[model samples]
Target: MLSSIKRFLIGRPLKSAELGEQKLNKTKALAILSSDALSSVAYGPEQILIVLITVSAAAFWYSIPIAIGVLLLLTALILSYRQIIFAYPHGGGAYVVSKENLGINPGLIAGGSLLVDYILTVAVSVSAGTDAITSAFPFLHDYTVVIAIVFVLFITTLNLRGVTESASVLAYPVYLFVVALFILIGVGVYNIVTGQVSPALHTPVGTPVIGISLFLLLKAFASGSSALTGVEAISNAIPNFKDPAPNNAAKTLVAMGTLLAILFSGIVVLAYYYGVQPIGEVTVVSQIAEQTFGRNFMYYFVQGTTALILILAANTGYSAFPLLAVNLAKDKFIPRMFTVRGDRLGYSNGIIILGFASILLILAFEGQTEQLIPLYAVGVFIPFTLSQSGMMVKWIREKPPGWGTKLFINTTGAVISLTVTLMFFLTKFGQVWSILIFLPLIILIFHRIHKHYEAVGDQLRLTTCEPSIPVAGNVIIVPVAGITHVVEFSLNYAKSLNPHQIIAVYVPFEREEEEIFEEKWKKWQPDVRLVTLHSPYRSIIQPLTRFIDTVVHKASESDYQVTVIIPQFIPKKGWHNILHNQSSLMIRAYLLYRRNVIVTTVPYHLKK
Candidate 1:
C-alpha cells in the first residue's frame, strides 16, 4: 500500500536508460530554470527604492542610475556565464569552475555560497510571493507564514515527481507572468508616450525617508543586486538540457538574460517616470500595475500572475540545488545519500532538504520579504566572483581561440563582482554578517566530510591476497513466539544456511504457555531443538539475548560463526504493524553491537 501511494504520487521508477528521455528542451527548460531570474523583477525594482526611499523622496530618482549599474553588471554576468556554459558544458557553474581553476578551498567557498543562495532563493521568493498575495487581499496577511510554507510544500511535491513534470506545471504561470509584465510595460509605455498617464496617487508610507549619503547610494546598489541572484541557476543546470546540451543551455541563458533585462529595465523606467513610491502596504511593481492597468480585471490578473510566478520561482532552486548537492557529494564534500536518485530520477533528498530549510527561514522571518532580502545578495556575489575568476584563469591557461577576449570579459566580471562583494560588506555587513559565519561553517563541514570518506576508504582498502579461513560450523538460532508456520518457514531458511545446530528458542511468560508450545513442538518434530526460557517480568529480549551470548561464547573456541534469524510477519497495511508488539525489534537492537554475531530477519508477508 505504501508503495502504491508512492507510485501514485511520484510515478513509477524510471530506468537509468530512461534518463535521457527526461531531458528538457530549451522552451520548457527556460520556464523551469528561468523562473527565479525572471521573477526577480517582481521585487528587484522595489529593493532599490527600499534603500533609496530611506534618504528622501527626491533621492528616489537615483533608482535609475542604480538600476543601470545593476544592468551593466547583469550584462557582464550573462556574458561570463555564457562562457561558463561552453567551457564546462556538464553543468560546472561556479563551484565546479572554481574548484577546477582556482583551488579546493575556493571551490568549497563557491559550493557553500551557491547552496545557501538556493535556500534563500526559495525563502525570499515564496515570502515575496505571499507578500504579493497579501497585498491583493489584506485579510490573508495574518496567515502569511502558513501560506508560504504550503506553497513551498506544493512546489516540493511537484519537483519530486520529476523535472519535466515540474516544468510543465510551472511553464504556464511563468509565461503568463511574462505576458502580463509585457502588457504592463507596453500599456505603461503607451500611456507615457501618448500623454494619457495620470498624476501619481499619494499613499501613506509607514517608513519615512531620511538624509542621503554616499553610503545610501552604495546600499541601494547592493540591494538592487538581489535581482541577479538566480542568474547563475541556468548555467548550473546545463546538463538538464536536451541534445546539444551546451548550445541549448547557452540559448536558454540568452533567452533568460533578454527577458530579465527588458522586464527589469522596463519596470525601473516605468516606476521612475510614473513617480512610484515605496509604500509600505503595496509594492513598486504593484503600483506600476495599478497605474498602467488601473483597478480592473487586468490589474488583478497581473497581480495574480506575479504571485504565482514568484512562488513557482522556488522551482529554480529545486532544480539546481539538488544537482549541486549531487556534484558536491560526488566529490566527497557532502553525504553520498544526496547522490541517489528517487523513483522519478530526481534528487529527492536534496529537494526535500531545500524545502524544509526554506520553511524554517519562512517561519523564523515570519514570511517578511524585507527581512530576508538583505541576507540574499551576499550568497550571490561570492559565486559570481569565483566563477568568473575561474574562467579568467581557464582562458589564459588553455589559450583557446579568442582566449584574450574571453579572458578580458571574465576578468571584468570578476573585478565587478569582487567590488560588489566588498561594497555590500562595507555598506550592509551588519544585516548580512550571517553569510560570513555560514560560509566558514560550511567549509568546515566539507572538510570533515572529506576526512570521513578518506577514513572509510582506508578501512575498506585491500593490499594483498589473504588465505580464507574455513568455517568449522554454523549455529543458527530462530527466536519464535509460537510453534506455527512462520517458525516452520524460518527453520527452512535456516536449513538453507547449512547450520550444524538449529535452536528454536521461545520465552514464555506463563508456565502453561510454555507447556503448550513444547507439546506442539514435540508432536511436530520440526528437526530442530526447541529451548524454552521462563521470564518473570514477561521480558522477551533479555532471555533471548542471553541465549545468543551463550551460543557466541561456545562458538568462540572454534572458527564457527553464530547467526540469529528472527521470524517476522509483515502486514499488508503499514498501520497494522503498530498493533503488534515486536519482540524481534528488541532482540535485534540488543544484539546490534554484539561482536561476530550476525542478525537476520526472515519476513513472512501476510496476504491481507
Candidate 2:
C-alpha cells in the first residue's frame, strides 16, 4: 500500500535511459533555478530601505548607489561562475570547487556554508512571501508561520514529483511576476518623466532623518546584497540542463542576471522617485504597485504575482541543495542516503531535509522577515569567497587559454566576496554567530564519517584463505521450553541437516515440571537425545546462551561445526503475538556479534 501511494504521488520510477527525458532546456532551467534571485526584487529593495531609513532621508538617496554596488558584485559573481561552469561541467558548486582547488577541509567549510544558506533561502523567501499575502489581506497575519510551512511542504512535493515537471508548473508564475514588474516600472517611470506626482500615502520619506555615517551606508549595502543569494544556483546544476549543458547554463545565468539587474534597479528607482518608504505591513514593492496602478486589479495582480514568485523562489534552494548534498555524500562528508535518486530522478532525501529545516526556521522566528534577514547573507558570502578563491587557484595552476583574464576576474571576485564575508560577520555578528558555530561541528562530523568509511573498507577487504575440506562433523542444539509442535518443527529441521549429533536441551525453573516433561519426551521416543539443565534463578536466556557457548567451544576444539536452531510461534494477527512471551527474540539478541556462532529460527504458524 505504501509503495502504491508513493507511485501515485511521485510517479513510477524512470529507467536509467529516461535521464535525458528529465533534462531541462534553457527556458525551464532558468525558471526553476532563477526564481530565488528574481524574487529578491520583492524584498531586496525593502531591506535596503529599512536599513538606510534608520539613518536619515539623506541616506535614502544612497539606495541607488548601494544597489549599483550590489549590481557590480552580481556582475563579478556571474563572470566567475561562468568560468566555474566551463571548468567543472559536471556541476561544480562551491563545495566541489573548493575541495578540488583549496583542499578537503576548506571544501567541507564551503559545503557547510552552502547548506545553511539553502535552508535560510527557503525560510526567508517563504516568510517574505507570507508577508506579501498578509499585506494584501491583513487577516492572514496571525497564521503566517503556518502558511509558510504549508508552502514549504507544497514546494517539496512538487520537486519530489520531478524536476522538469516542477519547472514547467512554476514557469508561469515567474513570467507573471516579470510581466507585472515591467508594467509597474514602465508606468512609474513614465509618470515621473511627465512631471506627474501623487500625494504620499501613510507617511513621507524617512519622516525624521537621523545622522548618516559610513557605517550606516555599509549596513545598507550589505542588506541590499541579499539580492545576490541565489546567483550561484544555476552554475551548481549544470548537469540538469540539455546537451551542451555548460553553454546552456551560462546563457541562462546571463539572462537571469539581466532580469535581476533590471527589476532590482527599476524598483529602487520607482520607490525613490515616488517617495515610497518602509511602512508597517505594506511592502515597498506593494507601495510602489499602489502608486503605479492604484488599488485596482493590476495592483493586486502585481502583489499576487510577487507573493507567488517569492514562494516559488524556494524552488531554487530545492534544486541546488539536493545536488550539493549528493556531491557531499559522494565525498563521504554526509550520509550516502542523500545520493540515492527518487523514482522521478530527484534527490528525495535532500528535498525532505530542506523542507523540515525551513519549517523549523519559520516556526522559530514566527515568520518574521526582519529576523530572518540578518541571518541570510552570512551563509551566502562564505561560499562565494571560497568558490572564487578556488577558481583563482585553478587558473593560476592550469594556465589554460585566456588564463590571465580569468585569473584577474576570479581574483577580483575573491577579494570582493571575502571583503563582504567579513563585513557581514562584523555588522551582523549577533544574528549570524550560530552559523560560525555550526561550521566546526559539521566539519567534525565529516571527519568522523570519513573515519567510519575507512574502517568499514579495511574490515571488508578480501584475503586469501585455505581451501575447504569435506565431511566436517556438524553439531545442532535446540532449546526446548516444552514438548510442543514448535519444538517438534525445530527438531525435524535439525535432522534434515544430517548433523553428526543433535541435542535437545531444556532449562526448567522447577524440578517437578522438568520431571513431567522428561517422562513425556521418553514416552515419545523421538530418536533424539534430551539434556535437562536446571537454572536456580529462572533466567531462560542466560542458561540457553551458556549451553550454546559450551557446545561451540567443544566443536571448535574438534574442528566441527555448530548450529543453534530455535523455534518461534507465528501468529496470524499482529495483536495476537503480544499474548505470547518472545523467548526466541531474547535468544537471538544474546547470540548477536558472537564470531563463528550460527543461529537459525524455525517458525510454526498457528491457526487463528
Candidate 3:
C-alpha cells in the first residue's frame, strides 16, 4: 500500500544512471539552498497579523518590531549556520549538528522536526500565495486542490530531471521576486515617507486599543516571530552550495538573510505607514498593492509579483527537505532508503514525499495559512532550539577563543529562539501544535523501535556456512513445467551441489501427462529421479509448496537433507514479467519460514 501510494505520488523510480547526469553551479546552487528562506515572504505577514488578531489592535504595530526581530534573527542564524557550514561542510543542517554534538535520538528529533516543518513550509507558503492569487482570479477561488497538485507535479518533474534543472528553472523567478519585492516595498515606503499617499492611506491605519497585558504581548511576539521558520535551510543546504563550500554558503546565507530582512522589514513599515490592515480584512495584500500603484498596470504588476514570489517560496521545501532526509538516512537514524540516491541524486523520493504531504496538508487544512501556522512553528522552532543548543555545546566543548566574540550573538539567538519556542508551545498547544508533538515523538519512538527490532533480528538471525558439505550432500529437488529453459539451468545447479540424488519434479495440470512424461524421458536427464505431481485447480505454488514440505519431512525421517530449485524466467518487458509464473515469489516466502530448506531462484533467460 505504501509502495502504491509512493508510485501515485512520485511516479516510477528511474535508474541511478539517470541521476548521474546532472550537476550544479552557483546559479543552480542558489535555487536549491535559498528556497526555504525565500518562502518566508508568503506567510511572514500573515503570521504577524494572526498573532495580533485577538490581542490589542495595537499588536499590529508590533509587526515592525517582529520584522526587525526576524531580520536580526535571520542574520544571526545565517552567520552561525555559516560557522556550521565550515564545521561540517556536508549538508544535513540541524540533524547533523545535533547528531554530532548530542546523539541519535536528538538527531532524530531534529530530523523529524525539520521534516514536519518542511511539509508545513510548502503547504503554508503555497496556500498563502494561492489566497493572494485567488483574489485576482475568481475562478481559482475553490480550485485549491487542482492548483496544489499542479504545483507538486510540476516541482516533482523538475526535481526528477535533477537538482540543477529545477534550480535553473526557478532562478529567474526568484530573481524577479527579489527585484519586485525590493521595488514594491521600496516605492511604497518611499511614498509613505514622502507623504505621497494614496486614497486608501487616507483611512486610519488601525485604532490602537491597549487591553492585552505584557504577557499577551510577549506571547503575540512569539507567535509573530514564526516569520523566521525557513531561516535555517541555508545551513542544511550548505553542501549543495558551489565549491569553497564555506565561502559560498556564507555568501549565500548573507545574501538570503539580507534580502529577506529588507523585504520583510520594508513590507512591515510600508503596511504600517500605508494602512495595509492584515487582520479581519479581505485581500489585505491586494488592497495594499492596488493602493500603492493605483494605475492598473503597475498595481497588477505588484500584486502578481508578490503572489508569484510567495508561491515560489515553496521551492525551499522542495529543495532542502530531501537533503535533510538524506543526511538522517546516512546517519542511520531514519531508514536506509532515505539515504539512497534517487534517479536525480537529489533525494528525489524525499522531495516527492514532502510535495505530496504538503498538498495533502493544503487540502486537509483547506490552504489556510492561519490554520497550519501552529503546526508549522512547533517543528521548526524545536530544531532551531536544539540546533543552537547543540552548537553551543560544541563551541563549549571545543573552547575556541574567538568564539567569545560571537558567544553573545549565539547566546542571545539561542535564548531568544528558545523562549519563542516555549511561547509557541504554550500558545499554540490546543490548536494544531498537537501534530508537532505527536510527529516528533512518533519519529523518536520509531527510531527506538527500529533499533530494538534490528537488535532482535540480529540475535535471531542464523549465520550459514557457505557451500560447506552438509554431513551429506542434500538431495536437489526442483519442479519444472517446461523443457530447455529453467529445467536445464536447475539440472546444471543440482550437479554443482553434487547431491546424494537429483530429483526433478513436474506438476502437470492437464490429461496430456502421459505424453508429457514421455517427452520428459526423451529430454536430457541427470543421473537422478523424476517425480510428477497432479494439480486439479491449475494452481502452481500451493501444490509445489506442499510437495516441498513432504519431501523435507521424508528427507528428515530418512536422515537426509534437501534443497529446492525455484525456476525464474528472465522477462524482457514489464508486462511479460508480470505474466510469468509468480510461484517463485510465493514459494520463497513459504520455504523461508521453515527449517533447513535451501530455496534458490534458478533464472533462465528467453532466447532472442
Best by TM-score: 2
RMSD of each: 3.9, 3.5, 5.2
Using Cα atoms with residue i matched to residue i, what is each candidate's TM-score against the true structure?
0.89, 0.90, 0.83
Model 2 per-residue lDDT tens digits across residues 212-321: 77777777788888888899998889889999999999999999999999999999888787777899799999999887888999999999999999999999999999
For model 1, what is the C-alpha lDDT against the true structure? 0.88
Query: What lDDT is reached at residue 150 by model 3?
Result: 75
The predicted structure with the larger TM-score, 1 or 3, is 1
TM-score of 1: 0.89
Best by lDDT: 1
Question: What's model 1's lDDT at 433?
Answer: 90
Error of 3 at 371 (Å): 2.1
Worst 10 residues of 2 by lDDT: 199-208
Candidate 1, backbone clash total: 1
lDDT of 3 by residue, 451-503 (tens): 86677666666663334334454777787766766777778887887788887
